[model samples]
Target: MRNYFIFVIVVFVSLSSSAQHTIKNTINNVELITVKDSKFFKGDKPYYFIGANYWYGPLIGAKNGGDRARLLKELDLMKAQGIDNLRILVGAEGDGGDSRVHPALQYEQGKYNNELLDGLDFLMAEMRKRNMYAVLYLNNNWIWSGGMSQYLEWNGYGTVPNPFLPDYSWDDYLNYTKQFHSCIPCKEAFYKHVKFIMERTNAYTNIKYINDNAIMSWQVANEPRVLISPDHETAFADWLNKTVDLIESLDSVHLISTGAEGKASYLQDIAMYQRLHSNKNIDYLTMHMWPKNWGWYSINNEKTSTITSIQNANAYLDEHILVAQKMKKPIVMSEFGFPREKESLNPTSSITNRDNFYKAVIDRITQSKVEKGVLAGLNFWGFAGFAKTNSENGKWLHGDDFTADPPQEPQGLNSVFASDITTLKLIKDANLLLIE
Candidate 1:
């Protein structure tokens, strides 16, 4: 009798485990992510991920002349820390510059560097191996990444109204990029690039790009903005809607979203934020927060400024959450970070304030998750794991291994690495508890 009972128990347990595995596979195999009551769903399971922006994942994962060792190690580290999603750049358009990643992918009209595309293929293949998902931005709104201004220049527009220029102010740069909304030829070239990426088959995985489950979403651009121009508002809407439609037609298996920095819309009009994302085809909403850019924090004075920045950040998140709730869609805080204490970039520098800020953000997300709120995901500004500045001044020089820190910013400014023990622990703990 005892032997019979033992066999029965073992059989029951095995059956239960098998059932769970089937359910997970079914969810993971879904063609497109669907929405259900403000939560993102893969089949029947609620989907959430603790993610990071590894914008250079493709470059590092490329098979031909790519950093395979570093890519493998970083992906291993990220998975070990409970990170399941990564937001990476698909590719950038236009020519390279002194302060940016040289030998860009799409430097000329309809021309591409096959090396970078292979890099993205390797990235997706490896992410699939780790059960990781990717949010691939198709373009960038900033100049550092050979973004929109490059497209404008490609169309015989005399100068790019260069943002990095000493004479140009920040607003001027934004206004210049806003023109990308109306540039017909520039928009057409961008669509071509998108189709090229979406239609390709992964060399490493033997899976078509659209069929690959590793891709979670295709973002239109990084933090696309309308600026203060009234005409550009109409233009931005047209561009966003058209782009989402184009992606949907090309690949219905994957999800699509706009990389808009919430509430910072050219007009700061909350209605525009709501209206822009109301499109049926847009899978989810994304928002980015920059305490330093918004003037809520000062890099020079970490102590007092960090305190105010945290407060401002809290309010900013809450506001976006309310908007997401109203729209009845899942939202991700796709970007948020603080400079090191005193804004130091050294590997050994203290991240005390930075850790505190992360804790606050995680705690809020946790609270929202518990409440069943609209916030479903969080991908901090970057994860630079082990990469350091190549230059003595702690700046990113040409030929340095690409880090999560973009060229527009100082190297190591917001990168969270393995050495950040306290911060890593907080992130891991949050990831473990915040999901079902």
Candidate 2:
């Protein structure tokens, strides 16, 4: 029975070790290539990405209400319509962005803390079960408690509002972040928090939906530090190099990309940070827009569409596609949502008008060869059912109606969900698309 005892011991040890992950397969060689003839890689496969950008549970504090089971059911509903991928944020928050330990794996941060990663694991696993893919957001735009810090901050948008408490100078922000208890990317916390999680995510998981290369790609940071100091080129390039280096050091076999909003800081303005970061290792490209929102930057986009706003966005899209094509990286319109009623910012087009915009954008993207090749997918902003999470802006940028409370609409404008999304097939394919 001594032999039987040895066998039992080995079995127990194996089962316990399985809980911790380690990379099983990695690329033998790596290359920095500018994608050409994206179709060249996937013969007649017609790889496509059609989905939505939804809130991340960690920051949103989602206890249940449509967590994974709900998301999976939605995906099933969409499959009948042809939409396939979903974008979820697995960002630089709490301990994830820190350099010490990922609060995702740690249970002590907050009840809502570990809940974030658990949600992701479930979502990713469900995606695999359903043969769907997800784009994981790595940063956010929300400010924190008593304005202490922001959990979910978006592209360059958050900084403009100076969301965080004590609106910090870029320098002060950096200094404060390094010493802050949470994980903040590029801060001392980043190395420990983000790096640790990156390593873990790279490890073998049965979530083949993402790992099968079926998933879209990883977005390094949201619209972030627009003008990287020192030098945009050096700063962004260094940032990209370090972030991806750490990610690949552990999980090297997957494709990487960014969900930047196509702004000078996010996607365009090659001399700016986005290009700097993207040029090095980004495998695909994605963007977000609100030409109406351009006023803040002094780029006034009159909402008179002979459909000009979406057109301008598409123009920017073209620029990005060319850039990605030049770099051999494909493109994904990962986050593009226009409002029905045009406001000064976060303009929401009318439900009817917005549908027109979606159609135009989709047609333009799908019809071009150079642009199409680079496009492995597209996911619109938001999924539904969580709109109640915040009656504040539930389901739409302008609230639920399109009356420009303007002249006096702090909540600028509102749009109807059903009618607006009716014309956009993406919504039908995936009902989650129209969520506020």
Candidate 3:
């Protein structure tokens, strides 16, 4: 018995030492995404490409309702099309309420749904295999993903006043969410979540997340905003700085981004956007544009408004790019989407207007690449490859297919489907230029 105990102890120590060596080896071998002189580089080459927002990746990667075959097929399609960089949601929080993502990664504070966690691991493993990189946003400012507001609700702040519901206004939701910045327990719980995700070792690859090159950056949140009032600025900045600091301290390898939506999220003040992003820990800048949401486009005046939308978008891009140039950090137009012609959600609807908008945006990135400008990359709203959707009413049912549009919105509002040949061609062409 004494001899057996000694042997077991020796084996355990040897295994531990082997694991440590493997982690060290992986770290040394991995070529992480790095920023130098306001541009992204993959090892030694300048890296830029047209990517997609595939936020439902983990959900589809899940073993339960997840369609791994679909996930694999979609990934293959994306890779073949030169759409390599993906902006993905790391996970959602709370119970899957109305308009919120289902199969929550964290159903309770500090308690996670292991299946979703496994799904994330599987997603990363598959992405690594394809030589793709992910920009994984940890939280969301909106209620659609049970984000900051969910944290507030979890800490007994009151039930989340979802704006989509008839009872609550957008102002009510924003006012409630802003409180999260100052809530001590809410912030602490969020910090715990950040640590939990960052410290994880991939089940499939046997690689620590800190050492995985598959991740391009760890985004603070999906469109994290100051919300409603100027008074919330200080608290928002404080929370943001601390969060980025925590992320930096945990993993000095991967890059950190704020996932901000430029002036839109900063009370329409570009200076405020610049000031908050001045943190040394923040390695890059990100901005999102929504022509329809921002009122730059109108369905009533389709043709004229499409032109107006393009002009406004160009100005927005230029404004943000100037900030990026001054800061000497790369900027990515991470999320932008245009609805089909006449605001139709049908897959077969004319995408002529959408195509034109995409071309204009892609052209800007290509032009920047030529001039070596700070506009490093862009990921259009989303890709919903091979997912069949009900086009009749465009309302997304509980078990309906995931698309570029979030659950709360019309199913195909801005989704780039596998069958969108014209749009895919535009994407492919732009990627070709970027690579050249």
Candidate 4:
């Protein structure tokens, strides 16, 4: 009788331990991406990717409220083409309706819409199924997503005071966006949103976000900048340091990035840019190239303008590459795109200039890979997939279906659709070399 009781107790203890081990394995099923010697790694292999800015992915993947069918098709499409990384906006804030960036996940402070969060879960779950990774930006520096400006308005500030106004100056917009760095209440509100998101569980997989490997990194904001303001620049440095540390503490598994628009954050000051990224918590570097926005191209003079734009782009890439190499960190051209010939948004329009532009960028990346340089990857401006706008020749307006085009840009501009075979091939060919 004594031997029988002892045997039963041993069996029970072994079963309990086995159960615990199973639960742990189930909760942490995915492999986390790691960084070493300035390069990203998955296990022992270098992690290089052909990615796209599917910023509207979560919105389209939301259950009942979004277009899930399209989301699945798009993911499958990207997977088929060997695209492996997706950069998406986790959520947007504001009381603005579809007139602004549709599907504001957190319109009021502390008031989150679970539907959107569930949508994000669905997106991540689908990406996991496809073996794709995501880089999610937590906030936007611009009002397109009801970003810093909206946060201020929520705190009793009046209008955004944007420079786009006929009478207002650009300095006004710069100063307005700059205010966010120092506003303690605003920062606290933003932090709450971050914590809430970090702590939330994915509805589909039942896996906590911190443990989910679908996410590659958490970007602090989209194109955050100090915009040449001395005081604001100082404050932003502090904010970046603290914010990255906070994210690191919250989720030690994933990487953290500033989501800065490269030299734009430091007003094209290379030294300042380097200093900003020197923080130990900042895992890698990012930069963006906008020939149109920076006045390197003109719509009226297509051939000449495009040539100049491409030249300028190459120079920009070269400079950024030197900077990244000096810092000994991998760099991603997170955003780069050119409009169709003559800046046309027409689906059937010629992409001669755009194609050449993409090829140039890809060639640089491929060369860098062969030489073991610092440039690691490139994510074009966006992927619109099958979504379309109501008007072919106008800015985005309310009542039109939301495409990949953000609210701030003209409809259909910079959207890489499934029909863009040439562009797709460029991406695929470049991706194949990296994977091989």
Predictions in order: lDDT: 0.81, 0.46, 0.91, 0.82
Candidate 1: pairs in clash: 62-119
Off by over 4 Å in 4: 1-29, 163-169
Model 3: per-residue Cα lDDT at residue 394? 78
Clashes of each: 1, 45, 0, 0
lDDT tens digits, residue span 1-436, model 3? 9999999999999999999998777554546789998899988988887999999999888888888999999999999889999999985888887967887888888899888888899999999888899999999998888989999999999999999999999999988999999999999999999999999999988888988999999999999988887888999999999999999999998999999999999999999999999999999999998999999899999899999999999999999999999999999999999999887878899999999999999999999889988899999998999988888787776677778788888889899999999999998888988888
Q: Pick the winner on TM-score between candidates 2 and 4.
A: 4
Global CA lDDT of candidate 2, please? 0.46
Off by over 4 Å in 1: 1-33
Q: Estimate, for each residue in 118-180, the C-alpha lDDT of model 2 and write its tens digit.
A: 556565544555555556655443221101133213111133223133555645554332222
lDDT of 1 at 360: 80
lDDT score for residue 278 of model 2:
51
Candidate 4 worst ten-residue window by lDDT: 390-399
Better of 3 and 4 by lDDT: 3
* Model 4: per-residue Cα lDDT over 1-436, one tens digit each: 9999999999999999999999887655655677888888876788777789899888888786688998999999888888888999976888654356766888787788778888899999999888788899998887778888778878876777755457667777777777888888888888888898888888888888888887888999999887655556689888778888899999987988888778876878878889889988788899998888889878888788888988998888888888888888888988887888776778788998889888988888888778767788788888888877644664676535566677767777778888889999999888999888
Model 1: per-residue Cα lDDT over 1-436, one tens digit each: 9999999999999999999898666445633456789887755777766789999887777667678898999999889888988999976666567476655778787888888888888888788888888999998888888888888888877576665678778787777777888999989988888898899988876678777777889899898877766567788889889999999999887878898888785467777788889998987888887887789888777778888988988888888888888878889989987878777887678889888788888888788778777888889979988775753366666667677788767888888876788888888888888665
Question: How many clashing pairs does model 1 include?
Answer: 1
